[model samples]
Target: MSKFTLRFNTIAAALALSGLFATNLAVAEDIRVISSGGFAQAYKNLASAYEKSSSDKLISGWGPSMGTTTNAIPVRMARGENIDVVIMVGDSLDTLMKEGKLVAGSKVVLANSLIACAVKTGNAKPDISTVEGLKQAFLQARTVAYSDSASGEYIKHQLMKKLGIAEQMQGKAAQIPATPVGEIIAHGEADFGCQQRSELLPVAGIDIVGLLPQEVQLSTPFSAAIVSGSKVQKNAQALLDFLSSEKNAGVIAETGLEPVAAKK
Candidate 1:
């Protein structure tokens, strides 16, 4: 071939590549996400992998699924925060959807989180293998910390009542607001702490004792949904799909949660 023809062909190929790059850049989106502590670790793990493989980007924020705290997902939504996606407790997500805060038909269960107890690192691990043992542990703890979210609500009300220790745990067992229960225990502010296992695992300086006894165990569903009126609905749905995909189940399980298989 002639030298001019070869040069023209190379330039054409370069222009095509440049156009393709620009198209990708144009299609890329920044999906804003707010996740409660229970699913944060798993969402983070899977998000990293998704970002590496896709042109989309994820901007994450943390909060509790149901609380009046300033950073709580519901509070943020009420204040009109610009969030595209929300990962939180399944029941909370349903409530939000019913209230029209989240897009209907967008909810997807990502994992099932079990309530667990923890103590400061190097501290004695208490046996909570039986209903009686769990009651004894709570009774023995001088100061117990639980979350300000769902698990905490259960511990403060139902669990204590069920164990017939509600009166005894009155002032000593308190909900730690907007903070992980594990953090309170790690700081030695509380002798025992209880919260979702996934939330506990992310905090350093704490050793998870074990899950709550089967009879009193609370298996909370952690789920994701797109925020209502989000400008980037398509991108938000893509993120939800990535998070609930079967391929990422192992990652979610590694974070101390039981991954829920995505519905077909």
Candidate 2:
């Protein structure tokens, strides 16, 4: 071929390649995910990065993994809502697996979520370092709020019992559903609040006092699973991969989530 002809052919190939790249960028898939507040921030971190890398859009919803309330993920699944993936407290995800709402062999631990205590940004940070301190904070606060999740359930049932202030907390504590406890405190609706640390870290206008004392602490592992019959199974798995990557460890930690140890 002549030099001019060769140059023209190369230019044509370059244009074709550019067109393919543009098409890939424009062709996007929507991956719908439902997870509890505990894992929402970490999931958001993964979703925002995944969208850029995969050219897929993420549609995420927040709620408890299981509950009698309409906002629960289990309730949404029962209503036949389409979901590509679920990130929630582990035992609840196990219930989905048992009920066949999620595919078998798709469950993976993402992180261990621990509970946190918070007060409004301008308020004095209360010490919850001891069991007595935790009890004092609740007894002294005018209003206390907690997520109506497993962590919250523990606070309502076990923690209150341990503190021996179960009766005192009655009517004084509020259970915030489908929302973070830190947010309620931030809004000044509640003078004291506790929720999953990951959920609290992302909310503005709140100061995280600290993790609950070991004597009254409750931690649950947050996990991800592909929803059964999802059309975007492959894409959902891609999101899980991004969340589980070693590079995301720092991001996860910053949100008060303990990265899951790699399985042997």
Using TM-score as the measure, the top candidate is 1
Please provide, for model 2 over 50-129, each residue's C-alpha lDDT reduced to its tens digit, 9 standing for 90 to 100: 88888999998877876777879888999999889998889989988998989899998988988889999989988999
Q: Report lDDT (CA) for all predictions.
A: 0.90, 0.86
TM-score of model number 1? 0.89
Worst lDDT run of 10 residues, candidate 1, spans: 21-30
TM-score against native, each model? 0.89, 0.85
Residue-pair clashes per prediction, in order, are 0, 0
Error in Å for residue 13 of model 1? 17
Error of 1 at 135 (Å): 0.6
Best by lDDT: 1
Candidate 2 global TM-score: 0.85
Residue 153 lDDT, candidate 1, scale 0-100 = 89
Candidate 1 lDDT over 62-121, as tens digits, reads 999888999999999999999999999989889999999999899988889899999899
